[model samples]
Target: MGQDYKEIAIKLFKQGKFDLAKISFNIAFNETPSDELLAFIELCDMAKDSPSDALTLFEIYFDPANDDSAQSINEIIDIMQSSVQQSTMEIESQNAITYADFKNLLNQNDFRTLFESILFSTRIIITHKDELFELVNFLVDHGFLDIGLKYLEGSAKMFMGDERMELMLEKIRGKDENSLK
Candidate 1:
């Protein structure tokens, strides 16, 4: 990595310029994902200055459908949960933001963009029966069927217990495709 890139990454991180820092770091890390750089990034994450950014980064690092990384998903999940617990943003700060409000929000186009971002990141951790069940059930209850389908597809890989797939296949067997459309 060039000295200028490192300087830019650090400056952006310090300025709370996370997305920019992430872009810079990706370029820099591409050249050298050395322990020093990785540790520095982790330090910035644990600094708790940007809870949502940290959580989102951790989510991308441990995707459920992709087990190609050297880092353990559990460790990443631990970090994400920590960030979530420490997040300062209100989950219901918008006007009339109830559970129903969030449900509707999840279905919105903008929210789907955010949802897809998280899905890409947390796919790995979300595949566990307990986690996947909780996540999918939450989205389903909130009327986010698109999110539910995404989680269900990922969780199916880990859900190898009974003939549940068979049962599910049966349930959808007689459904009217035209009506669904």
Candidate 2:
């Protein structure tokens, strides 16, 4: 059974299905722990952690007309990567902008920054309404209710009259209420 899981994970990984591969690898590890499974798990984690992966997920969830957010996120990632590589030593200087500063910029209503932050921090694949609801649930579960609320509100406004937005708001409200209980 462990070998079956490992084989399935390897096939999924080769097919670029990192999330599914990670799950299979985790199951295999539980049955029979192995360094190879651990390595695959690490690789999946890295793939999922990439900003590009998040951008792809954003594209999958949002409408084509809303590509502006994804574009802005791509630009931010490019700028961040270049700046970091060019001034590795100057990162500690005031000239360098840390990730937290970037989040602050988003909170300041810098439109591009806000969208970029959403794409970077939330690996949300909002394909269906249920998926969007799940993303909000995840954000709340992870103690990012405030940030998640902001993004949900922003998305609701961006795609005005979206029924899913209302549903998501209701679900989030329920989660908030439950948490306070």
Candidate 3:
């Protein structure tokens, strides 16, 4: 019976019906209590809240020994990426804040509070390198040195060995040091 539920969950998950998949996975987990099913449950929850983080969890759960796992992983990636694209489009349409308005907000004296509010409330997905650079610069210029540095450092992992990223890291570090004086 647990195996039946697990099978159903996997099918639903592959179909990108994550909410239904989660319910099925939860049922399977209650019946079988297996680590794999638990992981899948967690993955489904992460997928609901954060698809990007779900991809990381999916990679961790991937079985390199299984020949079919690679295909499954790719399929999951495609599904999650499409989901993220849809979400990004929705959020952009809803917010529709221009770069100039964003910068204006950042330049305000209460920008720290506003910035933190926006950062926590929004799922900013930078699709372009220039936008990423510009965002980091804005953060730095507005005294959000720590956040800007963290952003640049996180980006460095995705864009390894990119000279621009390296330069940004160095620039942020210099600013950080000078600010400490």
Flag the better candidate by lDDT, 2 or 3. 3
Assess every candidate by TM-score: 0.29, 0.34, 0.42
Query: Quick one: best lDDT, which candidate?
Result: 3
Write model 1 residue lDDT over 1-181, tens digit each, in one string. Answer: 4556767976776675665766676677778766435644664555334445555554455468767554544455466567555432343232222333344556765654645555543322321244445545555544565656665675565465536544443333323343377
Question: Please, what is the whole-model Cα lDDT of each candidate in the order they appear?
Answer: 0.53, 0.61, 0.72
- The Cα error of candidate 2 at residue 1, in Å, is 0.8
Per-residue lDDT tens digits for candidate 3, residues 88-131, read 67767775454556667767747667777777656455555567
Candidate 2 per-residue C-alpha lDDT over 1-181 given as tens digits, one digit per residue, 9 for 90 to 100 = 9999988987787676888988999999999996556655755664544525533543342456665754544554564456446555555443444444544564677544454566554433233334445556556666567767886875564445667677667877887888899
Q: For all candidates, what are the clash counts?
A: 4, 0, 0
Lowest summed-lDDT stretch of 10 residues in model 1?
88-97
Comparing 2 and 3 by TM-score, which wins?
3
lDDT of 1 at 115: 55
lDDT of 3 at 47: 68
RMSD of 3: 14.3
Cα TM-score of candidate 1: 0.29
The candidate scoring highest on TM-score is: 3
List the RMSD of every prediction in angstroms. Answer: 16.9, 14.0, 14.3
